[model samples]
Target: MFQIFTSFFIIYGSKGGCPMTITKKLVPVIIACCLLFSLFLPSVQAQAAAKFSDVDPQRYGWAMDAISFMTDRGILNGYPDNTFKPGNSLTKAEFTAMLYRLFDKYRPNMQEEDADLRLAGYADVPETHWAHKEITAIYDYYFGGIAFAFKEGVEEPFFQPEKKLTRLELAQIMYMAIPFADDAPGASCQVIMGMTDIPYELFSSYEEADEYRFDGRYSEDTGISVDYYVSEGAPVLYPLVLVKESDGSCSSSFDDYSSIIESAVASMHTSGIMTADDSGYFRPHAPVSRAEAVTILNRTYNYLKANRNLQQYSSLETSSAAAGTPVTNPQPEPPAGKPSSTVNPAGNVKTFTRDLAVEGELETMIDTEGYRSITVSIEAKEKVDVIVQLGGKKSFIRHEELPQTIALNGIKQVSLETQKRVFDLLNRDADYTAVLTVELK
Candidate 1:
């Protein structure tokens, strides 16, 4: 069409078949047409590249780019009828297949002779299963001290491939796949434990606390054999602290599962590899849709492509050692005659302020003598997550609840959670700072 139009214009203009005024007008029209054609060419090509029958542009527009990217690379495929069922829930087997394709470079090559030997372990994922190869491949690659999709509490050794994948599970897979620095999981747990809010006087009586006690040995989910207490009176039971054994190691039945989920979700959320919904909530237990799965996988791929130095967790033994190690040492006291930063020296109550950038942190030692309560006011120019650490305890503040005050009943040395390497990788551009005010009463 362009060739014919150009030929007609050339012949008509050269022979004066068209008047100069008309020819001058036609020249601008030709240029305009060329510019418009150039602009639409890519869109046309893109549309032809990955067209799905069921995905409506208005509803699934945000996911179309990701769907297209994955489809083009053959990481995701539409149904035989040419429909991409974006709303359908993603299953474990399906996710493994997608991950196997997405991270092909990271996995080992499986030989036909060795396939049966490697795949023989899973009782449910038989040779007849559709995603047996993918399951085998992913299971062979260990992450966070276990194989892919490894779960506790199963009576028989089986891989439930047809089970719908949850948001938390996907986040965990991505977290393991990226394999943050060696200390990341531990540091993430610290942030989680620190952010947990438990009232100091919740369990007023020993009997009340005893009623919520759980021995770690009895809980098959978390194999740590030790006694610990939880606040069962609350809507959700919150693990308080692990009981210290004669070996000085703390033990608790509150498994690493919750911590890992929290850590994975936090890492994913902060890094923009995956994000929460409009309410700033990452529904960890919610079932993942096919569209959401691909979109997240696409983001993970892009992140990995850009970041080449990411260290993968090598040995399960070493990785396990990185998480749940107890800190048994007593918190050191603040130096005498040294006043707290920005605090009034003469009063029983002390107030101080510190400023920090996104992913930035501040640490200060406060003499908590005669103080029964601690309050922190966070003021940020934009919404941001902040971690406040007091001695061994930590608290996390979400952005939505920002420009607000966080009050804790007990006093501990004031500090902020500082996992610099993890935060640095998560957010590089630290242009703004959140102001935190600490007050002891």
Candidate 2:
């Protein structure tokens, strides 16, 4: 037992000479390794059961792909109940446990003198977490003298280890330690702020948002908080990538932007939409057709909305002047182009009862260019038109009703997929803007 868990650490922990000499004093290590190896023998050849379908494909990016690969190699696994909660941030314990599964051992003698950073002892976890021993051991032996984000003596604290990680934060962590896969030439990590006009200072200096820009341009770098341009009557939030048409032609069309895929991947990485591969490449620039984009966006939106840390919309409920349920406060304005829908400040995520669609109609409007969110409630189950317009073009106007909710074993589940590749084709000229409408009655 002792040898079984200690071998990996001993090998990876040592530096000056042959750590793999199979020391005579630890002969029990050989026997224990054999016993455990035999006991869990069949698992060695086992394949992972996860796939891209196991993840939210669109928003997750290469992280999902890498996880699927490691999982299949038997170096990783799903939960006890057969679900891989991929979006959940890994606790230090959970991550260390995964490392153990990968190598199957520990290094108790490893000195943890120079920690990259130490977690301030949380009141609830004063070295009692199952991972305390392993984490301390690894820190002592392997990761000495490294500088991680936290302070050593535990003053203010890294308060939320359990908090979901953002895609960028995870990338930063991996980039700091692991080797990143290089981006293609001219496929640099570029962060665009004030999409209309990027800031001069941010171009060279640093900011939180600049990290994103640098991430796109440089493979690894620090962060900077990039703001929009103070001049040119730009919106309050500065430098975002304002993608224009080929001729600097300004069109609200979502179609002209295949370049956004890189942005999406970067966004996914920082926001925890995806996990990181020890290899740092996030292939965001690959070509993705609009159909793929829609599917990806839909899945990404679902994951983002489901996770609490990423939820940023302040108000969502909008009571139409006609028959919609009363929204407490006025709906917050929609993103550019879409007419503003009022929402409550309290920001209740309304579970649109199927009943709302039975009598009222979903309205659609657009006057600017950017992202927007709208939800239609169904008072009852019935065929209804969900009118969608992106960048001012009506893409899909169809009548469909939600499938009746069904219980599988003990949980409620829903699945949706588009039919016959609607809204996207191989042709380049098909891009168009749209406004969404969930028509009622």
Candidate 3:
């Protein structure tokens, strides 16, 4: 039996006069009634079920729900000592086993043999190994085509069955394995952009007039597009994980990578399939332990199960265009305008003459108004395509030589009050560097 005592006080103030205070105390019977009403309210501690001994209710509180959810579903379990070790590193074999179990747990019937027979033929993977099935399945899914390219003169193929899995490896693997929509990489029908000047006919999709438009590169025999790319003349492809944060603005912390992998990480991070560590780092180069891998896989499993009944695609309506038909290109025409400001490259810039793919982005604030023309001196290793967006207006230019100008009209003036004035140099496909200059009038 508990009691709560509260006193009410009212202050009466008069102009040019002293203030008076009136106080009233509630009856003991009324206090008792209030206490009785509070008895019906749920206790936060009572609602929580004791799941593990080591996972503290205070420190690891964020993961408590995920831990409980996984444990209840039988996807995760503690050690013989009844402690869930969240800090341990994950191994390759353990991860593979977890993945196999996850897919088996969800789509028990869809599991079948992949067409590639040699995938399971890794020398280290014995028929009796626990992860053989999963290793084989994933290997079959990305045969000689994934994140790590295939070498022409390699003596043998290896899955490194017992090796430790790195964070980047985990990201790549989880991304490739998950069954997501076509917008993501490695989907049954993948849409890839950023390649410039290639014939539009190269991109073909199964469904007509699809917004994705282009189908991923496919095999001549299978007629199915696979997720793979060539790096230094080697075919490579890999897997997925991601995290969807509360805020709509999403990004991954693994910044040191090429555009392709960066795009994958960004997609996964935004979709809530993967998350960063406590220090707010992705730890891309760090290895994941067996326990961590199992926990993450379990989380993924629970996500799938919860959303199992929901329709994957909301709209069944589709376009009626042919598969290989070229839709409108993403490039926009230059706007008409006069010069307003002058922008000249000041720092030393290098020109790349090697046969390699390199890319970057430059963001700057523009305070100029009216119509403008941009002039630059540049050379291309193969080709240079520059896309510029000034304020809300955009323009695209393909130049192989310096001392060239493109005019854009219908530009608006920048207001100091408004914070929306922005300019960007989208150097998406520039192999060699160039001396750039922009004039707005």
**Better structure of 1 and 3 per lDDT:** 1
TM-score of 2: 0.27
Ranking by lDDT: 1, 3, 2
> Which candidate number maximizes lDDT?
1
Runs off by more than 4 Å, candidate 1: 1-35, 42-50, 108-120, 140-156, 180-255, 309-441
Q: Rate the local accuracy (lDDT) of all candidates.
A: 0.50, 0.30, 0.39
Residue-wise lDDT of candidate 1 within 1-441, one digit each (tens)?
466557756767564475333456576687777777778565522462358778887787767777776776677788898888999998888888988776765453253233322333466677888898777666532232223323344422456678777776677777655633212212333333333232111233334444444433223433321211111131232344322223222222123323344556556665666666655555555789988988887666554333432123121122221111121223434433434332443454443333343112433455454566555555555444445545333344454544444454565455443221121222335334545565666
- Candidate 1's displacement at residue 389, Å, is 22
What is the per-residue lDDT of model 3 for residues 1-441, given as tens digits with 9 covering 90 to 100?
222323221122233554433223335555665777678864332222354567665765545555554455454567887677766666777766656554553221133232222243555567798776666655442323332222235534456666666766676666545532112112211111122211122212212222222233433333222433223333333221111122221111111122235544433444445555444455565777534465455455444334441122111112321111121112112122311122222322222222222112221223333446444343434344344443322233334333455454644321110000010111333333332344444
Please count the clashing residue pairs in each candidate, in the order shown.
Answer: 5, 63, 45
Q: Which ten residues in a row have the lowest lDDT in candidate 2?
A: 222-231
lDDT for each residue of candidate 2 in 1-441, tens digit (9 for 90 to 100): 555556764776467855755577656756666786778653211222233334554454424434543454444566666765555444444444443343333332252222322232433334766655544443221121121222334433232333332333333322222212222211222322212222212222122332444323211221111110011222222123222322222211111111222333333444333423445543322222222222232233333234321123112212212111111211112324322222222342323222211111222232222213333333222233343323211222233333222122321111111111111222234322222223211
For model 3, how big is the CA root-mean-square deviation? 19.0
lDDT of 2: 0.30
Error of 3 at 235 (Å): 19
